[model samples]
Target: YAASKGAAQGLAAGIQAGKGVAIKSLEKLGVKYFWTGMSSEILKMNHYKEVANLTDVIYTAKLKVCDELTYDNFVNMCEQFDIKIGVYTEEVKNALLPKYAVPNALNRIVSEAETTAKEVFEAESTRIAAEITEQQTAVINATYSSWQIAITASVIAIVVIVLIMVIIYLILRYRRKKKMKKKLQYIKLLEE
Candidate 1:
Protein backbone atom coordinates (compact mmCIF):
# COMPACT_ATOMS: atom_id res chain seq x y z
CA TYR A 1 0.00 0.00 0.00
CA ALA A 2 2.84 2.47 0.69
CA ALA A 3 4.41 1.75 -2.68
CA SER A 4 1.12 2.42 -4.53
CA LYS A 5 0.60 5.72 -2.61
CA GLY A 6 4.10 6.86 -3.47
CA ALA A 7 3.51 6.10 -7.17
CA ALA A 8 0.25 8.12 -7.13
CA GLN A 9 2.04 11.19 -5.66
CA GLY A 10 4.75 10.99 -8.26
CA LEU A 11 2.15 10.85 -11.07
CA ALA A 12 0.46 13.99 -9.74
CA ALA A 13 3.76 15.87 -9.58
CA GLY A 14 4.62 14.90 -13.16
CA ILE A 15 1.24 16.13 -14.40
CA GLN A 16 1.73 19.53 -12.69
CA ALA A 17 5.19 19.89 -14.26
CA GLY A 18 3.79 19.12 -17.74
CA LYS A 19 1.07 21.74 -17.30
CA GLY A 20 3.66 24.43 -16.34
CA VAL A 21 5.73 23.64 -19.38
CA ALA A 22 2.67 23.82 -21.70
CA ILE A 23 1.68 27.20 -20.30
CA LYS A 24 5.18 28.61 -20.76
CA SER A 25 5.36 27.35 -24.34
CA LEU A 26 1.97 28.98 -25.13
CA GLU A 27 3.21 32.28 -23.65
CA LYS A 28 6.31 32.26 -25.80
CA LEU A 29 4.29 31.44 -28.93
CA GLY A 30 1.89 34.32 -28.23
CA VAL A 31 4.78 36.78 -27.85
CA LYS A 32 6.37 35.60 -31.10
CA TYR A 33 3.10 36.08 -33.05
CA PHE A 34 2.51 39.49 -31.55
CA TRP A 35 5.90 40.76 -32.70
CA THR A 36 5.47 39.24 -36.17
CA GLY A 37 2.08 40.99 -36.59
CA MET A 38 3.60 44.29 -35.45
CA SER A 39 6.39 44.01 -38.02
CA SER A 40 3.86 43.41 -40.81
CA GLU A 41 1.81 46.42 -39.77
CA ILE A 42 4.96 48.60 -39.72
CA LEU A 43 5.86 47.46 -43.25
CA LYS A 44 2.32 48.26 -44.43
CA MET A 45 2.53 51.78 -42.95
CA ASN A 46 5.88 52.35 -44.76
CA HIS A 47 4.33 51.28 -48.08
CA TYR A 48 1.42 53.68 -47.58
CA LYS A 49 3.85 56.52 -46.82
CA GLU A 50 5.73 55.81 -50.07
CA VAL A 51 2.46 55.88 -51.99
CA ALA A 52 1.48 59.18 -50.43
CA ASN A 53 4.86 60.69 -51.37
CA LEU A 54 4.40 59.58 -54.99
CA THR A 55 0.94 61.13 -55.12
CA ASP A 56 2.29 64.39 -53.74
CA VAL A 57 4.93 64.50 -56.46
CA ILE A 58 2.33 63.91 -59.16
CA TYR A 59 0.10 66.62 -57.75
CA THR A 60 2.98 69.11 -57.74
CA ALA A 61 3.77 68.37 -61.37
CA LYS A 62 0.15 68.94 -62.37
CA LEU A 63 0.03 72.32 -60.60
CA LYS A 64 2.73 73.68 -62.97
CA VAL A 65 0.20 73.82 -65.79
CA CYS A 66 -2.38 75.78 -63.75
CA ASP A 67 -1.19 79.22 -64.84
CA GLU A 68 -1.70 78.40 -68.54
CA LEU A 69 -5.35 77.37 -68.10
CA THR A 70 -8.29 79.46 -69.39
CA TYR A 71 -11.56 79.87 -67.48
CA ASP A 72 -13.26 76.61 -68.60
CA ASN A 73 -9.91 74.84 -68.74
CA PHE A 74 -9.08 75.94 -65.22
CA VAL A 75 -12.41 74.68 -63.91
CA ASN A 76 -11.81 71.32 -65.62
CA MET A 77 -8.28 71.15 -64.27
CA CYS A 78 -9.37 71.94 -60.73
CA GLU A 79 -12.06 69.31 -60.93
CA GLN A 80 -9.63 66.74 -62.23
CA PHE A 81 -7.11 67.54 -59.52
CA ASP A 82 -9.73 67.16 -56.76
CA ILE A 83 -8.87 70.64 -55.53
CA LYS A 84 -10.97 71.97 -52.61
CA ILE A 85 -11.33 75.73 -51.98
CA GLY A 86 -11.70 77.05 -48.43
CA VAL A 87 -9.79 78.38 -45.45
CA TYR A 88 -8.24 75.31 -43.87
CA THR A 89 -6.66 77.03 -40.83
CA GLU A 90 -7.72 79.49 -38.18
CA GLU A 91 -5.13 82.06 -39.28
CA VAL A 92 -6.37 82.02 -42.90
CA LYS A 93 -10.01 82.11 -41.81
CA ASN A 94 -9.36 85.14 -39.62
CA ALA A 95 -7.28 86.97 -42.23
CA LEU A 96 -9.91 86.65 -44.97
CA LEU A 97 -13.06 88.75 -44.57
CA PRO A 98 -16.42 87.03 -44.93
CA LYS A 99 -18.07 87.35 -48.36
CA TYR A 100 -21.50 87.98 -46.76
CA ALA A 101 -20.42 90.89 -44.59
CA VAL A 102 -23.32 93.10 -45.64
CA PRO A 103 -25.91 90.41 -45.10
CA ASN A 104 -24.45 89.54 -41.72
CA ALA A 105 -24.45 93.21 -40.70
CA LEU A 106 -28.06 93.51 -41.79
CA ASN A 107 -28.94 90.42 -39.81
CA ARG A 108 -27.33 91.88 -36.71
CA ILE A 109 -29.24 95.12 -37.20
CA VAL A 110 -32.47 93.21 -37.58
CA SER A 111 -31.77 91.25 -34.39
CA GLU A 112 -31.15 94.47 -32.46
CA ALA A 113 -34.32 95.97 -33.86
CA GLU A 114 -36.28 92.92 -32.76
CA THR A 115 -34.82 93.16 -29.29
CA THR A 116 -35.69 96.87 -29.05
CA ALA A 117 -39.19 96.22 -30.29
CA LYS A 118 -39.64 93.56 -27.62
CA GLU A 119 -38.48 95.97 -24.92
CA VAL A 120 -40.83 98.67 -26.18
CA PHE A 121 -43.69 96.22 -26.23
CA GLU A 122 -43.00 95.23 -22.63
CA ALA A 123 -42.87 98.89 -21.55
CA GLU A 124 -46.10 99.70 -23.34
CA SER A 125 -47.79 96.76 -21.71
CA THR A 126 -46.64 97.94 -18.31
CA ARG A 127 -47.87 101.46 -18.98
CA ILE A 128 -51.22 100.20 -20.16
CA ALA A 129 -51.53 98.04 -17.07
CA ALA A 130 -50.81 101.06 -14.88
CA GLU A 131 -53.43 103.08 -16.73
CA ILE A 132 -55.95 100.32 -16.23
CA THR A 133 -55.22 100.26 -12.51
CA GLU A 134 -55.64 104.04 -12.27
CA GLN A 135 -58.92 103.90 -14.13
CA GLN A 136 -60.18 101.16 -11.81
CA THR A 137 -59.27 103.22 -8.75
CA ALA A 138 -61.02 106.26 -10.16
CA VAL A 139 -64.15 104.24 -10.90
CA ILE A 140 -64.22 102.87 -7.34
CA ASN A 141 -63.83 106.33 -5.86
CA ALA A 142 -66.61 107.78 -8.03
CA THR A 143 -68.94 104.95 -7.06
CA TYR A 144 -68.25 105.47 -3.37
CA SER A 145 -68.84 109.23 -3.62
CA SER A 146 -72.17 108.75 -5.42
CA TRP A 147 -73.31 106.26 -2.80
CA GLN A 148 -72.51 108.73 -0.02
CA ILE A 149 -74.49 111.48 -1.73
CA ALA A 150 -77.52 109.25 -2.19
CA ILE A 151 -77.50 108.16 1.47
CA THR A 152 -77.25 111.79 2.68
CA ALA A 153 -80.17 112.84 0.45
CA SER A 154 -82.35 110.03 1.81
CA VAL A 155 -81.70 110.98 5.47
CA ILE A 156 -82.53 114.63 4.82
CA ALA A 157 -85.79 113.73 3.10
CA ILE A 158 -86.85 111.52 6.05
CA VAL A 159 -86.18 114.30 8.60
CA VAL A 160 -88.19 116.90 6.59
CA ILE A 161 -91.19 114.53 6.32
CA VAL A 162 -91.26 113.88 10.12
CA LEU A 163 -91.27 117.64 10.89
CA ILE A 164 -94.19 118.31 8.50
CA MET A 165 -96.28 115.56 10.13
CA VAL A 166 -95.73 116.98 13.64
CA ILE A 167 -96.91 120.50 12.55
CA ILE A 168 -100.18 119.18 11.04
CA TYR A 169 -101.07 117.23 14.20
CA LEU A 170 -100.70 120.27 16.48
CA ILE A 171 -102.96 122.47 14.30
CA LEU A 172 -105.75 119.84 14.31
CA ARG A 173 -105.67 119.54 18.12
CA TYR A 174 -106.00 123.35 18.60
CA ARG A 175 -109.07 123.62 16.33
CA ARG A 176 -110.88 120.74 18.12
CA LYS A 177 -110.49 122.37 21.58
CA LYS A 178 -111.89 125.73 20.37
CA LYS A 179 -115.05 124.10 18.95
CA MET A 180 -115.70 122.14 22.21
CA LYS A 181 -115.72 125.33 24.32
CA LYS A 182 -118.33 127.05 22.12
CA LYS A 183 -120.69 124.07 22.42
CA LEU A 184 -120.48 124.08 26.23
CA GLN A 185 -121.54 127.78 26.45
CA TYR A 186 -124.61 127.18 24.26
CA ILE A 187 -125.81 124.30 26.46
CA LYS A 188 -125.63 126.43 29.67
CA LEU A 189 -127.84 129.21 28.18
CA LEU A 190 -130.50 126.69 27.13
CA GLU A 191 -130.70 125.22 30.64
CA GLU A 192 -131.31 128.68 32.30
Candidate 2:
Protein backbone atom coordinates (compact mmCIF):
# COMPACT_ATOMS: atom_id res chain seq x y z
CA TYR A 1 0.00 0.00 0.00
CA ALA A 2 2.81 2.41 0.90
CA ALA A 3 4.75 1.59 -2.30
CA SER A 4 1.57 2.02 -4.35
CA LYS A 5 0.96 5.39 -2.74
CA GLY A 6 4.60 6.51 -3.23
CA ALA A 7 4.82 5.60 -6.92
CA ALA A 8 1.33 6.94 -7.70
CA GLN A 9 1.66 10.19 -5.73
CA GLY A 10 0.37 12.16 -8.76
CA LEU A 11 -2.84 10.07 -8.74
CA ALA A 12 -3.24 10.55 -4.99
CA ALA A 13 -5.61 13.20 -3.67
CA GLY A 14 -4.12 15.97 -1.60
CA ILE A 15 -5.16 16.40 2.05
CA GLN A 16 -7.99 18.87 1.38
CA ALA A 17 -11.82 19.17 1.35
CA GLY A 18 -12.71 15.78 -0.18
CA LYS A 19 -9.21 14.29 -0.22
CA GLY A 20 -8.71 13.89 3.55
CA VAL A 21 -9.46 10.63 5.37
CA ALA A 22 -12.81 10.13 7.08
CA ILE A 23 -12.91 9.59 10.84
CA LYS A 24 -15.58 6.85 10.54
CA SER A 25 -13.29 4.25 8.90
CA LEU A 26 -10.43 4.99 11.27
CA GLU A 27 -12.75 4.73 14.28
CA LYS A 28 -14.07 1.37 13.09
CA LEU A 29 -10.60 -0.17 13.20
CA GLY A 30 -9.59 1.82 16.34
CA VAL A 31 -6.59 3.33 14.61
CA LYS A 32 -4.93 6.66 15.43
CA TYR A 33 -2.16 8.40 13.53
CA PHE A 34 -0.79 11.69 14.85
CA TRP A 35 1.50 12.61 11.97
CA THR A 36 3.63 15.70 12.45
CA GLY A 37 6.38 17.29 10.38
CA MET A 38 8.73 17.02 13.40
CA SER A 39 8.10 13.31 13.92
CA SER A 40 10.98 12.70 16.33
CA GLU A 41 9.82 15.30 18.87
CA ILE A 42 6.20 14.20 18.38
CA LEU A 43 7.10 10.59 19.19
CA LYS A 44 9.12 11.61 22.23
CA MET A 45 5.95 13.01 23.78
CA ASN A 46 3.48 10.40 22.48
CA HIS A 47 5.53 7.19 22.79
CA TYR A 48 4.88 6.89 26.53
CA LYS A 49 1.16 7.22 25.91
CA GLU A 50 1.36 4.49 23.26
CA VAL A 51 3.11 2.08 25.65
CA ALA A 52 0.63 2.82 28.39
CA ASN A 53 -2.24 2.22 25.97
CA LEU A 54 -0.89 -1.20 24.97
CA THR A 55 -0.09 -2.26 28.54
CA ASP A 56 -3.61 -1.33 29.65
CA VAL A 57 -5.12 -3.68 27.07
CA ILE A 58 -2.89 -6.64 28.04
CA TYR A 59 -2.97 -6.24 31.85
CA THR A 60 -6.11 -6.74 33.95
CA ALA A 61 -4.72 -5.01 37.06
CA LYS A 62 -5.68 -1.58 35.68
CA LEU A 63 -9.34 -2.44 35.17
CA LYS A 64 -12.46 -1.96 37.32
CA VAL A 65 -15.83 -3.70 37.65
CA CYS A 66 -19.09 -2.24 36.19
CA ASP A 67 -17.18 0.52 34.44
CA GLU A 68 -18.75 0.77 30.98
CA LEU A 69 -15.75 0.44 28.70
CA THR A 70 -15.07 0.45 24.98
CA TYR A 71 -11.92 1.05 22.90
CA ASP A 72 -10.70 4.19 24.65
CA ASN A 73 -10.94 2.32 27.96
CA PHE A 74 -7.57 0.78 27.12
CA VAL A 75 -6.01 4.23 26.70
CA ASN A 76 -7.42 5.30 30.05
CA MET A 77 -5.99 2.28 31.86
CA CYS A 78 -2.40 2.80 30.59
CA GLU A 79 -2.28 6.23 32.17
CA GLN A 80 -2.39 4.55 35.64
CA PHE A 81 -6.21 4.47 35.87
CA ASP A 82 -8.19 1.54 37.39
CA ILE A 83 -9.77 -1.00 35.02
CA LYS A 84 -13.01 -3.01 35.27
CA ILE A 85 -11.57 -6.53 34.98
CA GLY A 86 -9.14 -5.67 37.75
CA VAL A 87 -12.04 -5.43 40.20
CA TYR A 88 -13.60 -8.68 38.91
CA THR A 89 -10.44 -10.82 39.11
CA GLU A 90 -9.41 -9.33 42.46
CA GLU A 91 -12.59 -10.45 44.23
CA VAL A 92 -11.02 -13.78 45.19
CA LYS A 93 -9.54 -13.03 48.63
CA ASN A 94 -7.11 -15.91 48.94
CA ALA A 95 -6.69 -19.67 48.45
CA LEU A 96 -3.79 -22.12 48.06
CA LEU A 97 -0.11 -21.45 47.13
CA PRO A 98 1.49 -21.96 50.56
CA LYS A 99 4.24 -19.49 49.65
CA TYR A 100 1.63 -16.71 50.02
CA ALA A 101 2.20 -17.06 53.78
CA VAL A 102 5.48 -15.17 53.45
CA PRO A 103 5.08 -11.55 54.64
CA ASN A 104 7.81 -10.03 52.45
CA ALA A 105 6.90 -7.84 49.44
CA LEU A 106 9.24 -9.88 47.25
CA ASN A 107 7.29 -13.00 48.22
CA ARG A 108 4.10 -11.38 46.96
CA ILE A 109 5.79 -10.57 43.66
CA VAL A 110 7.00 -14.17 43.39
CA SER A 111 3.50 -15.45 44.12
CA GLU A 112 2.01 -13.27 41.38
CA ALA A 113 4.74 -14.34 38.95
CA GLU A 114 4.07 -18.02 39.69
CA THR A 115 0.32 -17.54 39.18
CA THR A 116 0.88 -15.79 35.84
CA ALA A 117 3.35 -18.52 34.78
CA LYS A 118 0.83 -21.27 35.61
CA GLU A 119 -1.89 -19.50 33.62
CA VAL A 120 0.48 -19.13 30.63
CA PHE A 121 1.45 -22.81 30.79
CA GLU A 122 -2.17 -23.98 30.98
CA ALA A 123 -3.21 -21.76 28.04
CA GLU A 124 -0.31 -23.10 25.88
CA SER A 125 -1.15 -26.72 26.79
CA THR A 126 -4.80 -26.22 25.86
CA ARG A 127 -3.90 -24.61 22.49
CA ILE A 128 -1.47 -27.41 21.56
CA ALA A 129 -3.92 -30.14 22.62
CA ALA A 130 -6.70 -28.57 20.56
CA GLU A 131 -4.45 -28.31 17.48
CA ILE A 132 -3.36 -31.95 17.79
CA THR A 133 -6.95 -33.15 18.24
CA GLU A 134 -8.07 -31.20 15.13
CA GLN A 135 -5.24 -32.62 12.98
CA GLN A 136 -5.90 -36.16 14.26
CA THR A 137 -9.58 -35.90 13.35
CA ALA A 138 -8.72 -34.61 9.85
CA VAL A 139 -6.32 -37.51 9.28
CA ILE A 140 -8.91 -40.03 10.45
CA ASN A 141 -11.61 -38.51 8.19
CA ALA A 142 -9.26 -38.56 5.19
CA THR A 143 -8.44 -42.21 5.83
CA TYR A 144 -12.13 -43.08 6.04
CA SER A 145 -12.81 -41.29 2.75
CA SER A 146 -9.98 -43.22 1.09
CA TRP A 147 -11.39 -46.56 2.35
CA GLN A 148 -14.77 -45.73 0.76
CA ILE A 149 -13.03 -45.41 -2.61
CA ALA A 150 -12.44 -49.22 -2.64
CA ILE A 151 -16.10 -49.81 -3.69
CA THR A 152 -15.59 -47.84 -6.94
CA ALA A 153 -15.37 -49.74 -10.36
CA SER A 154 -12.06 -50.51 -12.13
CA VAL A 155 -12.44 -47.30 -14.15
CA ILE A 156 -11.77 -45.37 -10.89
CA ALA A 157 -9.50 -48.04 -9.38
CA ILE A 158 -6.28 -46.09 -9.95
CA VAL A 159 -7.57 -42.96 -8.19
CA VAL A 160 -8.81 -45.07 -5.25
CA ILE A 161 -5.44 -46.83 -5.02
CA VAL A 162 -3.63 -43.48 -4.97
CA LEU A 163 -5.96 -42.18 -2.27
CA ILE A 164 -5.40 -45.28 -0.12
CA MET A 165 -1.64 -44.99 -0.62
CA VAL A 166 -1.66 -41.39 0.48
CA ILE A 167 -3.74 -42.26 3.56
CA ILE A 168 -1.35 -45.09 4.42
CA TYR A 169 1.60 -42.71 4.11
CA LEU A 170 0.01 -40.22 6.50
CA ILE A 171 -0.90 -42.90 9.07
CA LEU A 172 2.61 -44.36 8.91
CA ARG A 173 4.18 -40.92 9.34
CA TYR A 174 2.07 -40.29 12.46
CA ARG A 175 2.88 -43.72 13.87
CA ARG A 176 6.58 -43.31 13.14
CA LYS A 177 6.66 -40.07 15.15
CA LYS A 178 4.91 -41.74 18.08
CA LYS A 179 7.26 -44.70 17.89
CA MET A 180 10.32 -42.45 17.89
CA LYS A 181 8.99 -40.49 20.84
CA LYS A 182 7.94 -43.52 22.95
CA LYS A 183 9.98 -46.64 22.15
CA LEU A 184 12.63 -46.26 19.44
CA GLN A 185 14.51 -43.10 20.43
CA TYR A 186 14.75 -44.22 24.07
CA ILE A 187 16.73 -47.38 23.33
CA LYS A 188 16.13 -49.27 20.10
CA LEU A 189 16.03 -47.83 16.58
CA LEU A 190 13.98 -49.66 13.91
CA GLU A 191 13.61 -49.27 10.11
CA GLU A 192 10.36 -49.09 8.10
Candidate 3:
Protein backbone atom coordinates (compact mmCIF):
# COMPACT_ATOMS: atom_id res chain seq x y z
CA TYR A 1 0.00 0.00 0.00
CA ALA A 2 2.89 2.41 0.71
CA ALA A 3 4.51 1.63 -2.66
CA SER A 4 1.19 2.28 -4.45
CA LYS A 5 0.77 5.63 -2.67
CA GLY A 6 4.32 6.66 -3.68
CA ALA A 7 3.57 5.81 -7.34
CA ALA A 8 0.39 7.89 -7.24
CA GLN A 9 2.24 10.85 -5.81
CA GLY A 10 4.90 10.60 -8.49
CA LEU A 11 2.26 10.40 -11.21
CA ALA A 12 0.51 13.43 -9.82
CA ALA A 13 3.75 15.44 -9.84
CA GLY A 14 4.48 14.46 -13.44
CA ILE A 15 0.99 15.54 -14.50
CA GLN A 16 1.41 18.87 -12.79
CA ALA A 17 4.72 19.51 -14.54
CA GLY A 18 3.18 18.66 -17.88
CA LYS A 19 0.31 21.05 -17.24
CA GLY A 20 2.79 23.81 -16.34
CA VAL A 21 4.74 23.37 -19.60
CA ALA A 22 1.52 23.30 -21.59
CA ILE A 23 0.23 26.44 -19.95
CA LYS A 24 3.52 28.30 -20.59
CA SER A 25 3.54 27.21 -24.22
CA LEU A 26 -0.05 28.28 -24.68
CA GLU A 27 0.63 31.69 -23.19
CA LYS A 28 3.50 32.34 -25.62
CA LEU A 29 1.41 31.17 -28.56
CA GLY A 30 -1.51 33.35 -27.52
CA VAL A 31 0.73 36.41 -27.30
CA LYS A 32 2.21 35.75 -30.74
CA TYR A 33 -1.21 35.14 -32.30
CA PHE A 34 -2.64 38.29 -30.79
CA TRP A 35 0.24 40.47 -32.01
CA THR A 36 0.17 38.98 -35.50
CA GLY A 37 -3.56 39.56 -35.83
CA MET A 38 -3.23 43.08 -34.49
CA SER A 39 -0.43 43.85 -36.91
CA SER A 40 -2.47 42.56 -39.84
CA GLU A 41 -5.47 44.61 -38.84
CA ILE A 42 -3.38 47.71 -38.31
CA LEU A 43 -1.84 47.32 -41.76
CA LYS A 44 -5.36 47.46 -43.16
CA MET A 45 -6.16 50.82 -41.56
CA ASN A 46 -5.41 54.06 -43.43
CA HIS A 47 -3.37 55.85 -40.78
CA TYR A 48 -1.63 52.76 -39.41
CA LYS A 49 -0.90 51.18 -42.80
CA GLU A 50 2.26 53.14 -43.46
CA VAL A 51 3.70 52.55 -40.02
CA ALA A 52 2.61 48.91 -39.93
CA ASN A 53 4.06 48.21 -43.36
CA LEU A 54 7.37 49.68 -42.26
CA THR A 55 7.48 47.22 -39.32
CA ASP A 56 5.87 44.33 -41.17
CA VAL A 57 9.16 42.79 -42.20
CA ILE A 58 10.56 43.05 -38.70
CA TYR A 59 7.41 41.54 -37.17
CA THR A 60 7.46 38.64 -39.61
CA ALA A 61 11.11 37.98 -38.95
CA LYS A 62 10.75 38.08 -35.16
CA LEU A 63 7.31 36.53 -34.60
CA LYS A 64 8.01 33.06 -35.99
CA VAL A 65 5.44 31.09 -34.00
CA CYS A 66 3.34 29.67 -36.82
CA ASP A 67 4.41 26.07 -36.01
CA GLU A 68 3.81 26.41 -32.27
CA LEU A 69 1.18 24.12 -30.71
CA THR A 70 -2.23 25.59 -29.92
CA TYR A 71 -4.82 24.39 -27.37
CA ASP A 72 -6.33 22.06 -29.94
CA ASN A 73 -2.90 20.72 -30.79
CA PHE A 74 -2.25 20.09 -27.10
CA VAL A 75 -5.60 18.31 -26.78
CA ASN A 76 -4.82 16.17 -29.80
CA MET A 77 -1.41 15.32 -28.40
CA CYS A 78 -3.07 14.38 -25.12
CA GLU A 79 -5.51 12.17 -26.99
CA GLN A 80 -2.67 10.38 -28.76
CA PHE A 81 -1.07 9.76 -25.37
CA ASP A 82 -4.43 8.77 -23.83
CA ILE A 83 -4.35 11.51 -21.16
CA LYS A 84 -7.44 13.51 -20.13
CA ILE A 85 -7.33 17.15 -19.09
CA GLY A 86 -10.34 18.96 -17.72
CA VAL A 87 -11.30 22.53 -18.77
CA TYR A 88 -11.96 25.30 -16.26
CA THR A 89 -13.60 28.73 -16.59
CA GLU A 90 -12.10 32.03 -15.45
CA GLU A 91 -13.29 35.68 -15.29
CA VAL A 92 -10.42 36.94 -17.46
CA LYS A 93 -12.39 37.17 -20.70
CA ASN A 94 -14.31 40.31 -19.80
CA ALA A 95 -11.21 42.04 -18.54
CA LEU A 96 -9.14 41.12 -21.60
CA LEU A 97 -11.81 41.98 -24.17
CA PRO A 98 -12.01 45.63 -23.26
CA LYS A 99 -8.24 45.95 -22.99
CA TYR A 100 -7.46 44.35 -26.37
CA ALA A 101 -10.38 45.60 -28.44
CA VAL A 102 -8.44 47.81 -30.90
CA PRO A 103 -11.12 49.14 -33.24
CA ASN A 104 -12.96 51.30 -30.74
CA ALA A 105 -9.73 52.49 -29.20
CA LEU A 106 -8.30 53.51 -32.58
CA ASN A 107 -11.51 55.32 -33.52
CA ARG A 108 -11.47 57.29 -30.29
CA ILE A 109 -7.83 58.22 -30.78
CA VAL A 110 -8.38 59.45 -34.34
CA SER A 111 -11.42 61.45 -33.37
CA GLU A 112 -9.54 63.13 -30.55
CA ALA A 113 -6.61 63.94 -32.84
CA GLU A 114 -8.88 65.56 -35.44
CA THR A 115 -10.71 67.61 -32.84
CA THR A 116 -7.48 68.79 -31.24
CA ALA A 117 -6.00 69.75 -34.61
CA LYS A 118 -9.06 71.80 -35.53
CA GLU A 119 -9.02 73.64 -32.24
CA VAL A 120 -5.30 74.39 -32.54
CA PHE A 121 -5.73 75.70 -36.08
CA GLU A 122 -8.61 77.96 -35.09
CA ALA A 123 -6.68 79.35 -32.14
CA GLU A 124 -3.62 80.05 -34.28
CA SER A 125 -5.68 81.79 -36.94
CA THR A 126 -7.41 83.98 -34.40
CA ARG A 127 -4.09 84.87 -32.80
CA ILE A 128 -2.55 85.85 -36.13
CA ALA A 129 -5.56 87.99 -37.07
CA ALA A 130 -5.46 89.78 -33.75
CA GLU A 131 -1.74 90.47 -34.09
CA ILE A 132 -2.25 91.91 -37.56
CA THR A 133 -5.09 94.12 -36.39
CA GLU A 134 -3.02 95.37 -33.50
CA GLN A 135 -0.11 96.22 -35.80
CA GLN A 136 -2.42 98.05 -38.20
CA THR A 137 -3.89 100.06 -35.37
CA ALA A 138 -0.41 101.03 -34.22
CA VAL A 139 0.55 102.16 -37.73
CA ILE A 140 -2.65 104.23 -38.08
CA ASN A 141 -2.08 105.90 -34.73
CA ALA A 142 1.54 106.70 -35.61
CA THR A 143 0.48 108.29 -38.90
CA TYR A 144 -2.19 110.36 -37.20
CA SER A 145 0.28 111.52 -34.55
CA SER A 146 2.81 112.48 -37.24
CA TRP A 147 0.18 114.51 -39.10
CA GLN A 148 -0.80 116.31 -35.90
CA ILE A 149 2.83 117.15 -35.12
CA ALA A 150 3.37 118.50 -38.68
CA ILE A 151 0.21 120.65 -38.47
CA THR A 152 1.29 122.02 -35.13
CA ALA A 153 4.81 122.83 -36.39
CA SER A 154 3.36 124.60 -39.45
CA VAL A 155 1.04 126.75 -37.27
CA ILE A 156 3.96 127.67 -34.98
CA ALA A 157 6.12 128.67 -37.98
CA ILE A 158 3.34 130.88 -39.35
CA VAL A 159 2.87 132.62 -36.03
CA VAL A 160 6.63 133.26 -35.67
CA ILE A 161 6.89 134.69 -39.22
CA VAL A 162 3.95 137.12 -38.58
CA LEU A 163 5.50 138.36 -35.29
CA ILE A 164 8.87 138.98 -36.97
CA MET A 165 7.18 140.97 -39.78
CA VAL A 166 5.21 143.15 -37.31
CA ILE A 167 8.36 143.96 -35.31
CA ILE A 168 10.26 145.01 -38.52
CA TYR A 169 7.36 147.31 -39.58
CA LEU A 170 7.27 149.07 -36.19
CA ILE A 171 11.06 149.63 -36.23
CA LEU A 172 10.90 151.16 -39.78
CA ARG A 173 8.02 153.48 -38.87
CA TYR A 174 9.88 154.77 -35.79
CA ARG A 175 13.09 155.48 -37.79
CA ARG A 176 11.16 157.35 -40.56
CA LYS A 177 9.41 159.59 -37.98
CA LYS A 178 12.74 160.49 -36.37
CA LYS A 179 14.22 161.42 -39.80
CA MET A 180 11.19 163.61 -40.63
CA LYS A 181 11.49 165.44 -37.32
CA LYS A 182 15.21 166.23 -37.98
CA LYS A 183 14.40 167.52 -41.49
CA LEU A 184 11.61 169.79 -40.19
CA GLN A 185 13.95 171.38 -37.58
CA TYR A 186 16.59 172.05 -40.24
CA ILE A 187 14.00 173.64 -42.50
CA LYS A 188 12.83 175.89 -39.64
CA LEU A 189 16.40 176.92 -38.89
CA LEU A 190 16.93 177.82 -42.59
CA GLU A 191 13.71 179.91 -42.63
CA GLU A 192 14.67 181.79 -39.43
Best by TM-score: 3
Ranking by TM-score: 3, 1, 2
Off by over 4 Å in 1: 1-97, 132-151, 174-192
- Per-residue accuracy of model 3 over 14-60 as CA lDDT, tens digit each: 33333333233323324333244443433344442132132333233
Clashing pairs in model 3, backbone N/Cα/C closer than 3 A: none
**What lDDT is reached at residue 80 by model 3?**
27
TM-score, candidate 1, is 0.33
lDDT of 1 at 67: 49
Best by lDDT: 3
Consecutive 10-residue window with the lowest summed lDDT within model 1: 81-90
lDDT of candidates 1 onward, in order: 0.44, 0.38, 0.46
CA deviation > 4 Å runs, candidate 2: 1-103, 152-192
Model 2 Cα lDDT, one tens digit per residue, 1-192: 333433233122211111112222222222232111222332343221122233332222223321434457555433322112122123443432212221222233334434443454455555555666677789899998887765566549778899999999999999999987887565655553
Q: What TM-score would each prediction reach against the true structure?
A: 0.33, 0.27, 0.42
Measured on C-alpha atoms, candidate 3 has an lDDT of 0.46
**What is the per-residue lDDT of model 1 for residues 1-192, given as tens digits with 9 covering 90 to 100?**
333443444444433333333223323323222222332332343221222122222333334444445578654543433312111123333322223332333234334434444455455555555666677789999999999999999999999999999898888888888888888888888998
* Candidate 3 positional error at 169, Å: 1.3
What is the Cα-based lDDT of residue 64 in candidate 2?
34
